[model samples]
Each structure stands twice: as C-alpha cells, then as structure tokens.
Target: MIPELDGATWHKSTYSGNSGGCVERGILPTGRQAVRDTKDRERGALLFGPSAWQAFVNAVRDGEFGG
Candidate 1:
C-alpha cells in the first residue's frame, strides 16, 4: 500500500545543478521512497518499496542510464 505524504520531508539532489526541472524524493513512514517532480508537486508522487527503490538508486550510482 502507498503511504501518506502529508508531512513527509522531501528534498532534491544537490547535484541537480540549478535546473528547475529536477525531482524530489521523500521517505514515507512505511520506509518506502516517494518521488515527484519538483515543479509539479501538486500531481503527487510515485511510491516505491524499499528494495525497488534501492535497486533504482544503485543503478543510478552505477550510471546505468548513461546520464
């Protein structure tokens, strides 16, 4: 089930440069991660289970998407 984001702490990457098109990520109470567009927060977010989120993060760190 998706967790509520009412009081979640969302933050964007420092490495996101000065672009206004970056996204934000927040940790839900259930330990899942929620991601949303920084510029369109009103649209809500995509919730990922802990393991799926970890795998995605690892892939990014490994440059799997080639930037």
Candidate 2:
C-alpha cells in the first residue's frame, strides 16, 4: 500500500546535472521512498521500499544507467 505523501518534503541532489531533468526523492510516512520528476510535480510519484530505493541508488552510482 502507498503511504501518505501529503507532508512529504522532496528534494533533488546538489550533484544533479544542469539540465534540470532529474527526479526528486522524498521519504514517505511509512518509511518508503517516493520519486517524482522535477518538471512534473502534479503527475504523482513512484513509491519504493527502503531496500529497493537503496538498490536503485547503488545501481545509479555504479553507472548502471550510463553516464
């Protein structure tokens, strides 16, 4: 089940590229992570459990999605 995101505070990384084409992440009330596009806040977000979010971050750090 999705957690309540009403009061979630989303933030983008300072290391994000200058293109402004990145996603912001927020921690939900249930401890899951929520992600949404920087340019489309009204579109909603994707929710991920703590472990899944960690794995995704690790993959990105490892360049799994390419530089």
Candidate 3:
C-alpha cells in the first residue's frame, strides 16, 4: 500500500540548472519516489514505487530510452 507522502524533501537532478531544463526528485520515507519539474514545484508530482523506479534507472543506464 502506498503511504501518505506529502512534505517529502525534494532534490534536483545533478544535471539540472537555471537553464530551464530541470527535474526534481524526492524519495519518500516509504521508499517511494516522487518527481516534478523544477520550474514548477507547486504543480503535482509523479510518484513511483521503488521497483518501478529501479527498473527505470536500469533502463536509462542501459540506454533503453535512446539517450
């Protein structure tokens, strides 16, 4: 079950900057992950479970998304 995850402390991606292409991430105490656009923190965030997040990271590392 997903836990209540408001108020999580978010961190910007290392690749993010003031150039307007930024992604912010936050890991909840429940191990879920949250992502949002750095330029609009007030907007809704996208949440992912730990397993899904890991899979996404692995895919990125494998260049599955065609970086």
Q: What is the alpha-carbon lDDT of model 3 when measured against the actual structure?
A: 0.80
Stronger candidate by lDDT (2 vs 3): 2
- Alpha-carbon shift of residue 18 in model 2 (angstroms): 3.3
| Number of colliding residue pairs in model 2 | 0
Could you tell me the lDDT of residue 3 within candidate 3?
Answer: 38
lDDT of 3 by residue, 1-67 (tens): 2234475778889977678889988888877888888888677688889889998789878999874
List RMSD in Å for every model shown. Answer: 2.3, 2.4, 3.2
lDDT of each: 0.83, 0.83, 0.80
Instruction: Estimate, for each residue in 1-63, the C-alpha lDDT of model 2 and write its tens digit.
Output: 334878687889666688887888987777888988888878888888989999999998999
lDDT of 1 by residue, 1-67 (tens): 3348876788996667775769899977778889988888788898889889999999989999886
Clashes of each: 0, 0, 0
Quote model 3's TM-score. Answer: 0.75
User: Per-residue error at 67 for model 3, in Å?
Assistant: 4.0
